[model samples]
Target: MSETAVPLPAPVFDPARVRSAVEERLTTFLDAKAQLAAAQGFPAEVTDVLQDLILGDGKRIRPVLCVAGWRAAGGCGDEGPVLRVAASLEMFHAFALVHDDVMDRSATRRGRPSAHEAIAARHVGRPDAARLGMDAAVLLGDLALAWSDELFHAARLGPDQLAAATAVLDGMRTELMYGQYLDLLATGRPSADVDAALRIARFKSAKYTVERPLQLGAVLAGADVGVRTALSAFGLPLGEAFQLRDDLLGAFGDPSETGKPAAEDLREGKHTALLARALRRATGTERDLLTGYSQGVPPGPAEVVRIRAVLEGTGARAEVEVMIEERRRQALRVLEEAGLPPAAGAILRAAASTLIGPAR
Candidate 1:
């Protein structure tokens, strides 16, 4: 039988405290790895760069949600194992981001050079610098993935908890990889299939980012199927809304705030819903510009203005805003009906607001 502890009365938890614990766990784990690498004469630069990326100014959203899921599912007693699991999730996230950036050829991450770019920059003069960076960054991403497993193992879960958590983690990783595959297949070959774009978002962001993390925590707490079901109901639509907002911000948000190159998504010809809507409504030169995969439009002021006009002029932006709102409402309605612990519901409510910016 699963070893779920009884829920504390009302089970109030501070998000700040959870975030701090997860951060500390990641920091200390990485620190030990760094020292071991130094003593063993492994390349110190690997851990050095990873430290900056993992311990940087990330929002710690996944880890916090994991803890919230734990509390919501009546996890009690030692919080240590759950925190370590949360940190492992973050490390896995770092792996995903590194590979995603490589796939996107994204030069920047969080307003700094991305992993490949940074590695390439460090060895500026080599003839194979670009290829070398790409290769080395893939290795770095793999290392992060490896460490994620190591940290997860070090959590020292009991037999039942370990089995359950492993199932959740395995499913999450498999779904994420296949989602990335779908995304890669669809990218740069956009069509007016809103459903197609949404499918990508569902797998790529919704299930991978929100649903699985919440489930992982719940499973760690030995939650029953019913509680896990409630979490999925609450998490899926909210996660999709989160990605929809991300698509908008990618095309239209302030680069400083978003921490990426302006219009990076459009520049890559990503098959986002916003782009699909625009294509469905566009005509003549507007359509031509939207389909200009081979035109080599330079990422400059005029190009930015023109693409902005396209996304805005077609009403796609407004349409997607409606989509986001609709999904957010759906998720909230699920929350109200899920009969979750009050504290978990509150954390999720706040999370929804923050992800989509407090509903205008």
Candidate 2:
């Protein structure tokens, strides 16, 4: 299997172009909301914060995958409606990120204050500032979600397209919420059950991050079950690889590079596949040290250093790397056998690299 599925997609299917088009649509949509808020005497800060968070730097992966799915399933011509739907996916993503940060109490994202943090910072001196910020951020996330719905409604899709897209969107939202719930339950309880950890990754990140987005686009193009099935076979494994890489990033990536606190998963005690595997492989004192962490031991600098040693010593980190590679290769093989449109296949293969390859 190819190590890297090189991407030379046509301009219309290019990831960069898809990202630019989606971002511009989001900016325009938010600008209209801002104007309406000003007219209604609503707080401008609402749109302002939404703008800063949604318009902030993003990989736009969902939107890109959606478009790729459409093209792969033979969608073509007059991409205006498709772009609008893509932008709505991004709005939905902003909702997910805002709530995710609030849930994790994450301080920063993409190198800036998370939505809750930014909102709290705005009212620094108030006695209820922290609580107020959390409340406001929750509201903001809901508003983003509602607006995403409105955006989708306004996409002017044909009746067939709308019905198809709605079914996929409904499933995606439900899966994402349940995935998050699973993750919440599992947090602070790292375990040796690698399958359990993997289950969380599949629902919490894999499906929404890859599978549904692909299906959403394909359905919009009136894709048959065969095309959607093929995409799923390719997407699920690749999505798993994506989440594994994210676990590694949260465990060990630099703050400057990852734009978040270091060892966040460790600090939060997320029961990730990486942690699960380490627990599985460890022995004696090393196993105890690893178990101590799963039991809520503070991951202070020295403690984290020791845990890192355990992760390395047990070769769990290395094992996870091998897992990622295996998943990636599986997706590549699927892509090859799926016999998708050449251009669409190229776009997806390229996405695989960006999703699981070395982080930018």
Question: Candidate 1 has what TM-score?
Answer: 0.94
lDDT of 1 by residue, 1-360 (tens): 899898557546777888889989999999999999999999877887788888888878788888878877888889999999999999999999899999988888988888898888778899999898899999999999999999899899999999999998998898889889989998778888999999989888888788888888999999999899999998899889999999999889899999987778766778899889999999779877776742334467677778789889999999999999999999899888988877778878887886678886
Worst 10 residues of 2 by lDDT: 290-299
The sequence of per-residue lDDT tens digits that candidate 2 reaches over residues 142-211 is: 9999999999988899999998999999999999999999999988777899999999999989999999
Residue 198, candidate 1: Cα error in Å is 0.9
Q: In candidate 1, which residue pairs clash?
A: none
Candidate 2 backbone collisions, by pair = none
Q: What is the lDDT of residue 27 in candidate 1?
A: 90
**Ten residues in sequence with the least summed lDDT for candidate 1:** 290-299
Q: Which stretches of candidate 2 lie over 4 Å from their true place?
A: 1-12, 283-300, 358-360
lDDT of 2 at 236: 96
TM-score, one value per model = 0.94, 0.92
- Models, CA RMSD each: 4.0, 5.6
